[model samples]
Target: MDSGKARATPSFSAVRTKRAFEAVTDQIRTQLANGLLRQGDRLPAERELAEQFGLSRNTVREGLRALEVAGLVELKKGATGGAFIRRGQAEVVVSSFSDLYRLGAIRAEHLTEGRLIVGTAVTRLACQRATLEDIDLLQENVDDSAGSDAQTALSVNLDFHRLLARATSNPVLIVLTDALIGVQRELLKIYEPASQIDVIASRRRLLTHLRSRDEVAAVSEMEQHLRLLQSHYLEEDFRYRRRVAAEAKAAGEAASDEA
Candidate 1:
């Protein structure tokens, strides 16, 4: 119990408990990432996972619920009932984003800031590690944005970001990119359709940055591009909302005075 340097580190019992839950999550995540657990792969029964992990069935259920919420697994009832892996989990990302947006836990500005930081980081990483094919994929994604609606362009633009993250050959980076891109998708829903010329111009600049393989320049360009977007779209949303609230308050006050 001494407060000095000789005291042993606190026992990791609590840490271990938390890690157990994470262990369960990681095991399933690993299977999915490695292709061992494909979409529609039926999870082992709760009893089976509990026995394997040396935990109670209730703990296993809790782990399953967490995965379900994370869009990794789905549970169904009836003759064919159990947890099934989802093949395409984009919906999970969308749902999670919608929840945050609805709760105001995530704001348009926050999404723009995340894109500025993470997008620039990914671009820099791509400059170092991108393969020729990766570059082509990114260019194609950029090209697709040229003619698409804002929502479609946003999706393809995120595809480019995710591709860049994958080109870094870092699984952690890819997952982080996906999380931020998911939020970005939500923020895009509020913007008007992007102009064809503007989309193409942005993509062309981005591709040029990638091809040059100048990490500093690529990162700098990405940050500037996102900053402009924040000013154009996200800041406008803030201004519009404030204006509406001010008008509503003025109308209510005038009505009360007339009464």
Candidate 2:
């Protein structure tokens, strides 16, 4: 018998007790959510967390890594190096959505629908609640977009949406909307350089509507702007699907010939 086979399977009971890194991550997340940990609060040393949880240092490290990616904790180095709670983290939430899109877990239509719902709501709220400062911020973004290259313009355009969301003064809405838009921005990775002209014109129109404070017009403009943006992605998706179907048909024919 092979040495490994001779050793026999580990007892089911032993395997059942095996540690999972995600379990440790969940516990830390629970602590943070329960307010047992507050922003800027430092976590116990890694060795302490490991010992407390009856886990290896590597298990504890994995938990910290998860929390760090989630934007819940920050690990710093220097005289003081430990995990600390973070304040509001809309960007991280957004990036997480982007990752999902890249993995083919989300589609272009999902992004378009999210944009319609969130974009319209935020535009309406900004119309009613935006202060002079908020309007100025939007104008600044418009100016920045005018001279930016394609990629830079996309960044500024996303920033403009973030500023508009913040102008609503609803932290929950801002965070949630940013999360959806973040996914859309990630998908834009393939199309940004080609979208320069559309982005420039869209930014200009949004600023105009906001400046005029026409709530109805602003909302309408936003919807139309997003429609234009969605069209580009939809076209790409249509092409991709066609290509995939052709490849599948070709593969089927090859298999039949082999048989």
Candidate 3:
């Protein structure tokens, strides 16, 4: 076998440390970093890995479980099943953001402000880099959003942001946009949406700027729209908190009267 291909084998040395599982994971991580192991490549059987690492099968299994949780590998069962290298996924980032929001570590202000920053940059870059097809797609998204129910409008509006990020041709921006939007979706569940007609109109203006390749106008339009959205969100969040407080007060009064 070619030396390059041979490197794909479970050629890890016997680990002499007490924390053998860490060593097992370290070796596998190194291989992945070196490109010796790639997506869809399966590791050797548990028995083989244990032998190579000079550790128990259980210890090797523990390392594999850790890899699975880290999103570095996927474990499968039955015939034709083993630990396989996984391609990078944006969902991991999305999930992490969602968790932070749920834990109250990420507030509405943080999400909305981040969106403004990212959305403006995405618009500027997309205006410079977008193809004719990208513009058409964005127009189509806006058209679909119009005349839809509130729920459908919300979905399509979020999709527009995703499409704009995609137009930038920057994967990092796309991933960050997805993560921010994912968290915003969760935040939206707690508050009412702003005016859909206003959103649609702003989108039309944004598309016009994009079609003209006017980065300055496109970015300005996006920032203005996002600021309006931020104000609307903050106002709605205030109302939601007040509503909850009122309901709690009413419940307490009712309980005191009964007592």
By TM-score, the best candidate is: 3
lDDT string, candidate 1, 62-84, tens digits: 87888888878888887778888
- After superposing candidate 2 on the true structure, give the runs of residues whose Cα lies further than 4 Å from its correct spot: 1-17, 20-23, 54-58, 149-151, 192-205, 243-259
TM-score of 1: 0.65
Q: 245 in model 3: Cα distance from truth in Å?
A: 3.7
After superposing candidate 1, which stretches have Cα over 4 Å from the reference? 1-63, 71-94, 148-154, 193-196, 250-259
Every model's Cα RMSD, please?
9.7, 11.1, 3.0
Ranking by TM-score: 3, 2, 1
Full candidate order by lDDT, most accurate first: 3, 2, 1
- Model 2, range 1-259, lDDT digits (tens) per residue? 1223232221111111355677777777767666566677777788877777777779778878888887888889877888887776787867777888989888888887788888889999998999999999888888888888766777887888889999999997798788887786777665432366776777677777887888998899899888877777788777777888999999999999999
| lDDT (0 to 1) per candidate | 0.73, 0.77, 0.90
The best candidate by lDDT is 3
Question: Which pairs clash in the backbone of model 2?
Answer: none
* Error at 188, model 3, angstroms: 1.3
The residue pairs that clash in candidate 1, if any, are: none
Better of 2 and 3 by lDDT: 3
> How does each model score on TM-score?
0.65, 0.74, 0.87
**Candidate 3: residue 64 Cα off by (Å):** 1.9
- Residue 31 miss distance in model 3 (angstroms): 2.5
